[model samples]
Target: ILNFKNLEYFNMDFCTAFSNSFLQMSELMASLKYLSLSNSYLNGTILDQGLCELVYLQEVNIDRNNLSGSLPWCLANLTYLRLLDVSFNQLTENISSSPLMNLTYIEELWLSNNHFQISISLEPFFNHSKLKFFDGDIYAEIETSHSSLTPKFQLTSISLFGHGDSGIFPKFLYHQHDLEYVDLSHLNLTREFPNWLLEKNKKLKRLSLVNISLFGPFPLPIHCHKNLRVLDVSNNKLQGHIPIEIGEVLPNLVVLNVATNAFNGSIPSSFGNTWPWGCFYLEYLVLSNNSLQGQLFSKEFNLTKLKRLNLDGNHFIGDIPKTLSNCSALQGLYISDNNISGNIPTRLGNLSFLDAIMMPNNRLEGPIPSAFCQLRHLEILDLSRNNISGSLPSCSSPFNIRRVHLSKNMLQGPLLGDLSYNRLNSNIPDWMNRLPQLRYLILANNGLEGEMPLQLCWLNKLQLVDLSHNNLSGQIPHCLYNISFNYREDNHDLFDQDPQILYQLPQLQILYTNYHNHKYLTNFTTKQRLYTYEVQPLHSMSGLDLSCNKLIGEIPLQIGELSRIHTLNLSHNNLTGESPVTFSHMKQVESLDLSYNNLNGKIPPRLIELNALAVFSVAFNNLSGKTPDRVAQFGTFEEDSYEGNPFLCGQPLLKSCNENGP
Candidate 1:
C-alpha cells in the first residue's frame, strides 16, 4: 500500500484484496501511465463514461477475476497503452471488432482463461508491430501476411495451464528456434509429449510435462539435450526401464523425477558411472512406487553434494551401501518397504544432519547402533518390522525427534540406562522432557518395559503412540490425554489388576490395545468387569483396534464416540457384545474388522452409509443377517480379513444369511 508519486509501473498482480481497494486509487490512477491488476477480484463491466481522462496511460492489466461485462470505449483513448491484458475474467467481447484494436502501439495482448469466444477472423490485431506476446483461445494468424514478414524479436515466455486458452497444444509451435522455459502442466493435453520438446533443444533450461496423459512404455525415443537441468515426467502412464544412456542424451540433467509411474525394469547397474563423470550431479533421486526391482546400487553415486535419495516401495533388496558414507552431505535417505536386509552400516549414524531414515518392513537385524544417537538431527527413524534385537538406549538426541517406529522388532528389555530424561548426567538426558517433540511413538512388539514412564507424556508433540505387545505394565499416564495414538493403545491396568489403572489417553485417533495378555505366546482370557463409561472427546482417534487379545465383557457403547474412525479392528478378542445402535457414529470407517471375537448380533444395514467402508469382516463372529448389498469389498476379502466368524453369512463365506433385516 505504499503511495507512489511517479510510478513507472504499477501491477496489482493476483492481489484480490488490493483490487477491491483500487476504488481509492481513482485519482492516483489518472496521473499514472502503466497500470496492471492481473488476477484480482475486480467486478462490474468496463464503463466508457470518463473514457480518455487518463490520456497518459500506457499499459493496463485486469486479468483473471470475476470482472464481467462488455468492452468500454474508454479503453481506446489510451493510445500509448501497449500491453493490454484482460485474461481469465468473465469478459464477453469480440476480438477483431473491439475498440482494443485501436491501441496501435499494443505490445502484448492476453485474454486467456476467460469466456471470450474466438471468432474466425482474428488476424486484424496480428499486424501490431509491437504485439509479440499474446495469450488467448483464438488461433488467429498472428503475423502480417507477407512473403517474408518477420515476427519481432520479442517472443520468449508463455503459460498455458488449461483449455479455453490457446486451443490445445498450439499447432503453430514449430520453427521458433529461441526458447528458455515452457510449462504445459495439467492441461489434459491428450498427445504424446511433443517430440519437438527435445528437438527444439535451444537454450531451454526447464520443461515440465507433468500428467499430460503422455502414455507410453517410453515416451521419449530420443534424449539429446545437453543443458536441460530439470526434467519432471511424473504421474504419467510411462513404462519400461529408463534408457540407461539417459546421461549420454542429457549430460546436464540434474533433477530427474519419474516417480509414481508404472515403469517395469531393473535399475541399470552402471547407473552412476554412466553419468558423464557426474554429468547429472543428481542431488535428488526419487524412483519409488514402480515395479522396479534391483539392488539400489547406491554405492555408485559418490556425489559429495547429493542430499535426497529415495528408492522405496520398489522390489529392492541387498545390504544398504557402506560407501554411502562417502556422500557426506546426504540429508534424507528413504528405502522403506523394500526387500532390503542386513544390518545397517555403523557409519550410517555419520550422516550428521540426516533428517529421516525410512527403512521399515525390511529384514534388517542386529541392535540399532547406539551410535545412531550421534545423528543429533534425525527427525524420523523408521526401523519398524525389522528383526533388530536388543534393548534401545534412552536416546540422547540433541535435536527434537518427531517420529520413532521400532514396532514389530525383536528389540528387548528395558532401555539401557535410567531411561528417564531427568537422569541426564547419570545417563538419561533431561532434555528428553524438555524436548516436547515426539510425534509418532510406535514401539509395538518390542520387549520394552518399566511402568510406562510418566515422563513420556511430556512429549506434547505425540501424534501416534503404539506401545502394544510390550512388557509395559503401569497405569497409562493421565497426562498423555493430548497425544494421538495411531496403532495401539496402552491397556487398562497396563495389564495388571492394579487399581491405579490409567483409564485413557484421550487424544488417540487410532487405538490398538493388546486386549488381554502381555507375554507373547500366551492366550489372554481376562474376567474384567464391564463398566458403563462415557469416553471424553476422543473423536480424534479414528481407527480403534482391540484385536488379538482376550477380554471378557461387552464393548462399551461409548466406543461410538470415535466418529472419525476409518478402521476398527476388534477381532481375536474374548469380548461379547451385540452390535450397539451407537455404532452409527462410525460413519467414516472403511475397514470394520470384528471377526474372531465372541460378538453376537445382526449386521447393521444402515452401516452401509459408511460409504467409505471398503473392508467389512465379521466372518468368525456369531452374527446373523443377510449381508448388505453394500458389503462389496467385504465379500471380496480373503477369509482372513474376515475369518473366524461363525454366524456371519456372505458370498465369500459358507454361511448364507436369509434376510437383509438386522
Candidate 2:
C-alpha cells in the first residue's frame, strides 16, 4: 500500500497476480530496497517504468515470468543495485552494450535460460569490482575483440555454457583466485584439460567441465584441497590412468564421475585407502564406458561411505569383491557389460539398504543368492544375459520389489520368475499367487508349457503380461479383465523411513543427486516393432502380448472392459467367433492385432471409433464382410491389414464388396 512509505522490502513471489494499482502504489515506496516478483505471473516488458524508477533499489528478482523485450535502458538509474535475477524469461538483449554495463555495484547476476547474446569474452564486466557470481546463457559465443583483459572482481562462482565450438577457454578465468564453483559444460571447447584452474583456485568446492571436448590426461592438483567436494569430467575424450594419489589430493570428495571417456588402466588402489587422519567420505564413484580392466577391488579396500558404484561397459574381470559387503550404506550397484565371471557374491546380501542391482550381459553363473531376501528396500533386480541356473530361491522380504529381469539364462524350475529367454521348461509358476505386489510378469521366449493358470487373475495389480514365444495353451480366461492395468497407486509411503528415498534424507540427496535420472527399461514387441519402454512411459503403458503362442478359444468380449489398455495382441492363435464388437470401448487402444486366426463373421465396423488406434490388423483370418469404414484412423490402414481374408472386401482391397457378395 502507498500508505507504507517506510516499506523497505516488497515480495509478491508465487502470487497469482498483482492489482493494477499495486505498481502505482509500489512507486511511492521510495525506500524499498528489495523487490521480488518471481513466478508472480507478471507479463509484458517487466515493470521497468515503475520499478527502475526506484533508484535506491538494491535487489530486483523477476525470474520465471513471461516478461519479454530487451533489458530496459532505464535500469541504469539504479546505480546502487547489488543483485539482478532475470533468469527463466523470454527477454532478449546483447550483454555487451546492455544497461547491465552501468550497474558497476552489482554483486550477483543471473541471466541463464534467456535469449541474451553473451560474448565469451569477459571484458564487458571488468569494471564490476564487487561482482561475486555470474550465470550466463548456453548460447554464448566468442567475441571479435580478442583482448586479454584482467577483471577487477574476484568471483566465487561463474558459469557460462556456450554453443558449438567456442574456440578456447576464457582467458579471464586465469586471474580468478577466489572461485568456489565453476561450470563450463557443453561449451565445445575442443581444447586440452585446464589443470591450471584447479592449481589457482585452492578453495574450489565444485567443478563441472562435462562434454566440453576436453582431451589429454586428467592431471590432478599437486596440492590437496580438502574443501573440494564434487568433480565431474564425464563425456569427454580424456585418456590415461586416473591419478593413484587422488584419495590424498581431494580427500573430502562426495562425487567423482568420469564416465564415457577413453580412460584405460585399472582403477587406482588409492581410492580404497582412507586419509592419514580420517576415513574417505566418497559416496558416488562412476567410471562406466571406458577401457579399464583388471580385478574390480583389492582385499584391503575400505570405502565404508560408498553408496552407488557404476563400472559398466568396461573390460573389468574377476569375481565381485566380497569386500564390497563392507559398504553397509551401499544402494545401487551397476557392473553390466563386462567380462566379470563367477557366482554373484552371496555377501552382497549384507547390504540391507541396497535397492537396485544391474549386472546384465556378463559371465555370471549360479542361482540368485537367497541372502538377497534381506534387502527389504530393494526395488529393481536385473541379472539378464548370464549363465545363472537353478531354481529361484524364495525368502520373501522385498515387498517393495517392482521390476525383475532374469531373461537369457539357464535357469529352470517351477518358481516365481521373470525367466524369459531361458531354459525353463516347467509350467508357469503357480506360486506367483503369493506375491500380491507383483506388477510385471515377463516370461516370454521360454519352453514353459501349460494351461493359463487361474491364479494370474488374483494379481489385480499386474500391468504388463508377456507370454509370447512360448508353448503355453489354454482357453482365454474370462476373469483376465479383473486385472486393473491402471496406473500404479502411489506406494512411496511404504518407504517413508528408507534413506534410499532421496527426498526424505538430505544427506543421501547429496550422494544420489543423479539417482532419479536412472531409467528402468524393458523390451516389448508391439505393432510388429520391438520397443524399449523406460520407467515413466512404462508406467502409463498397459498391454497384453500373447502372440506366437498355442492359445486356442473364442476371443473374450469382457476384454473390452479394459478401456485404459493401450495394446492388445492375441494373434497367431486358434481363436474362433466374430471379432468382439465391445472392442470399441477401448478408448486408449493404440495397437490391436488379432491376425493369423480362424475367426469368422462380420468385422466390427464400430471399431472405426478407435481414434487413438495407430496400428490395426485382423489379416490372415477366416472372416467375411466389408472392412471397417475407411474413416478416421482406418483411413490410414493398408491392404495388408485386410489381406489373407479372401471373402473380406472393401476400399483397401482390389475386390469390391458388391462382386464378393458380402
Candidate 3:
C-alpha cells in the first residue's frame, strides 16, 4: 500500500488480483503521469472528481476486468494525458464529448472487450498520428471493414470487429504503406485480401493474411519492399509453385512461412543464399503442405543462420545436400513427404546442437550413420516411409530423444530383440540397451529377427514401440501392453497387410491387423528367408527390416504383448486364423499395414475403436462378415483395399444385407 506519489506509469488490467486498493495512492496520482487500474477488480462509478484530481496523468489502462459505471463527464482537467484504455468492463458510458472532447493531446483510446450497450461512434478523436493501435470492431478503419464510412484516427493497425466485434478484414489495409505488423488472426473474417497488397507494398515489414480466404500463387515482387521481413500467409486457399526466384522477391526477409498452403514446385534454389553475401539470409522457413518437387535441400546454398526449416508434405526429391551441414546454427529440420534419395549425409551428425529431424515419407537410402549418435541434444527424429536400410548405430551418450520413428523402411535386424509381427534376423540391438529415456520407438517393415529382450520392458520411460512388417515372429512382449504413454492416433493400423484378423488394441490403434501384401505371399509358410531389399535411415541405428518376406503362421495372440509398437506392417504374409483377442493392449501404434494376407474373420469392432489409426489397410485379405460400421474411417475402404476379400461387406465396398432376413 505504498503511496506512489510521483508515479509515471501504472497499468493494473491483467492483474485481476487487487482493487481500488490502489486508490490509497491518491497522494501519488497528484503528480502521476500514467495510471491504469484496469480489471483489477475496479468497480463502482468513475467519478469526474476522482479522475480530475490527477491533473498530470498521461496514460491510463483499465481493460478486461469488471469495472462498472458511466464515463466521467467533465471539463478537460487532465490536459496532459495522452492514452486511455478502458476496455472489457461493464461501463454504460457514452464517449461523445464531455471531458473526452477537450483532451486533444490524447493519442490512443481503447474501449473494447466490455459490455457497453450504447452504440459507439468515433467522432471525438480525429487526426491523432500516434493513435495507430486501435482494437475494436465498432467501425474502426474505413478501408478494411465495410462498417464505418469515416475513420476518426489515422490508424496504422486497427482490429475492429462487427456486432460484438467479429472483426472484419480491412480491404485497403495494404495501401497503408506505413503499417508494420497487421494481425487480424482468427477473428472470423470471411473476406479475401485485396489484390492491391502486392502493388502498394511500401515500408510494411510484417504482413499476415493468415486464415483468410486468399487464393492464387502469392505474386509478391521482391523489389516492392526493401525493408519487408516476415510474410506469413498460412492456412489459406493459395496454390501453385513457390516462385523459384523467391530469394529475389524479398531479399532482406527473415521468416517466410507459407504453411498449409497449396503451393507446388521445388523450393526455390535461390533461397540457399548465406549471410554477408548471398541468398535470402533467412532464419526461419516453413513451406509445408505445398506440392513442391525436386531436392528440397541442395548443395547450392548455405543458410548458415537458419534455425528452423519445415518442408513437410511437399513432393521435393533428391538427397539432402551435404553442404547443408554449413547451417551451423540449425536447430529444427523437417523435410518429410518428399522424393529425396541417397544416403543421409553423415555431415549432419556434426551438428552437435541439432535438436529435431523429421524427414519421413521420402526415398532416402543407406544405413543410419553412427555420426547422428553424437547429437546428445536431439529431441525428435522421425524418418518413416523411406527407402532407408541398415541397423541402428551404437548410441554413445545419454540421448535426450523423446520421439524416434524409423518405420516403413527397408531396415533389417532385431529391435532390442523384441518382435511384433515376425522374428528378428540379428541379436537384440545393443544401442537400445543404453536408451533409458526412449519414449517412442518404431522399427516396422524390415528383415529383423531374434527374441525380444526383457530389459526393454524396464524402460519406464518407454511409450510407443512399432516393430511390425519384419521377420519378427514370436510372442509379443508384455511391458508394452500395460505401460502407458499419451497414445492417440497412432495405434489404429498397428499390424496391417498380414494374413490375419485384428481383434484388439485396448488403448491404441491396431488399424490393419490383416495387412494384405498378397503379391509377396508365394512362399509365405516356407521361406523363413529375409527379403533382400536394401535400406538405410537418417538416424544411425541398429535398424531391422524383413519387409516383403513371405513369412506365415497363426496370428499369434501373443502379438498383443508389444504394447508400444508404432509401425506394424505384417502384410504379404500367408498367415492364417482370427486375430488374437489380446492385441487390444498396444495403445501406441502409428502405422499398421496388414494387407495381402490369408486372414479370415469378421473385422473386430474392438479394433475399430482405436482412436489413433493413421494408416489403416486390410486390403486383399480373406477378412469377412460385414466390416464394422462404427468408425467412419474404417468404412472408407477403396475397391483395392478390400478387393480380394469376398466375405467383407459394408460401405467402401458394397454392403450386402442378410440373404435369409431383412
Which candidate's TM-score is highest? Answer: 2
Per-candidate clashes come to 13, 0, 114
Model 2 Cα shift for residue 49 (angstroms)? 6.9
Q: On residues 1-662, what C-alpha lDDT tens digit does candidate 3 reach at each position?
A: 36565666666655755565555446656777777775476676666226667777877776655667777763277777777777777766445434666776677666665544322234454434356665543433222323444444555544443342334444335335555555454444545444355446465666655565567766656453556666777777787777666676667777777887788766777787543333456777877776777766667777777777777767777778888898887887877767778999999999876787878767888888889888877876767667777766766544577556565566665443122232236645655656775644544434565655666655655443445455545443544433343333233244332111211222221111112210011011111233322111211111112335455666667555565555455677666777666645655554456677788876666766555555566788888776656464455445665567877776667657486521
Q: Assess each prediction's global lDDT (C-alpha) against the native.
A: 0.57, 0.82, 0.58
Query: Which ranges of candidate 3 are over 4 A from the true structure?
Result: 9-17, 24-28, 36-55, 61-80, 84-105, 108-129, 136-175, 186-201, 221-224, 273-279, 297-299, 414-437, 441-662
Residue 509 alpha-carbon offset, candidate 1, angstroms: 30
On the 0 to 100 scale, the lDDT of residue 165 in model 3 is 38
Better of 1 and 3 by TM-score: 1
Best by lDDT: 2
Model 2's lDDT to the true fold? 0.82
Worst 10 residues of 3 by lDDT: 517-526
Q: Worst 10-residue stretch by lDDT in candidate 1?
A: 517-526
The candidate, 1 or 2, that scores higher on lDDT is 2
CA shift at 404, candidate 2, in angstroms? 1.4
Give the per-residue Cα lDDT of candidate 2 at 508: 55
